[model samples]
Target: MVTYLLDIMEYADSDQVIEVLGGAVSTRVIRHPNRSFAFEVTLDLEKGSEHFSTKPPLHFHANQDEFIQATEGKIGLELEGTEYILLPGQDEYCIESWANHRSYPLELERQEGRTVVKFLLSGAKSPEVYELNTLFFENWYKYQEHVVRKGGKIDLIQALSTFDAGGTYVSFPRWVPFGRQVSQLIGIVVGRWLGGLLGYQPFYREWSTDWQLACDKMESSIFQRRWAVRSKPD
Candidate 1:
């Protein structure tokens, strides 16, 4: 792990391209503070292929709050258990902490070539696991795209692990009482404990920005920090 960390550190000096979903999505970070991080995401799916899902399953942030607004075109958003289409002029949707939400591409917006949306993230919880910032999104989106481009599946354990790394927990059916708690427990055990036993990690050098950056950020938790490879300072 230390050798791999050293190998990837050579590339960390340069900025990584923020594209994902087989190049269907691009992102840029505008603000990067832990409490008020901001960024723009552009989704440009292929013509007549809006069915392709470029988003993750509905999940809830245990410690983060998300806000989204369409700046250029329309985007499909499912928030607070209600699915809706958000136009450019629509009001910013504040996804409170623990709210169930997901975002995906839209067909109607493809006519304009691309849909640009801005997102604001604030650390809503104590951030004891991981903070919601550009680094978290970097590994999260890149890993998803890596799996898609490989035309293969990354086991459920790996997926859950990444969700945990980003402070996102799988949201169980809302109808079930105490579903959120159940989901979090499943993620920590299956994604963190079992996945770690199987040598799976929440962050990978192949899909993330820098080895040390992740190592530094994940120090908030022992489980999260252990998977990030590190070396002694020279």
Candidate 2:
């Protein structure tokens, strides 16, 4: 299985991309096939280091509070620079528009790896996110290293523009005709690679299972359901 580092700079504002405090985090946003809604979550992997940084001045969702949890591994909540170790199975909350809060992995040597997911509820859909994501990744394959340095940062500014205005459903345009199909396949391919590299034997085998479940739950507009699970990060 291949694990792509969550290069949010590909689809988000680079300056807005917060480094997950303590673990390797991969974030993916899956949009609903028939609606203006989208579900985004980050899978936090256990790391050798104990420090991470948050993107300050987060104002993405002024109307909603984000629901977050450490589904797997160890993490310490960083609220305005103070650290609070969050036990496995514990849940946390944050208001993105209000508090400048973020999380990092705990510093303990014996702490197990962890996975954290965030449910963002927003009505504004950014059409440029789809455009830039498709274009950036497409160019990435052809130009590879050159694309990253040359024009990668442009994607985020465009995404922010599409999402700048407030609305009930963030309107991300479905520019690629086969977007749903492609995203599913990417999920499967990425999941498999990640599992193999991280030794999630059983977990790797179930990547498709989790992707399907996440897709199904997305249809119902419920991001918190147990069925909407992603792979467990080690």
TM-score of each: 0.77, 0.32
Q: Model 2, range 39-75, lDDT digits (tens) per residue?
A: 3434343342321333222222323343344444555
How far residue 169's Cα lies from its native spot in candidate 1, in Å, is: 1.2
Clashing pairs in 1: none
For model 1, state the Cα shift of residue 136 in Å.
Answer: 2.0
Each prediction's Cα RMSD?
A: 8.7, 17.5
Question: Relative to the unseen true structure, what is the C-alpha lDDT of residue 83 in candidate 1, on a scale of 0 to 100?
Answer: 85
> Candidate 2 — which residues are off by over 4 angstroms?
1-60, 106-110, 113-234
Task: Give the Cα lDDT of each candidate.
Answer: 0.65, 0.33
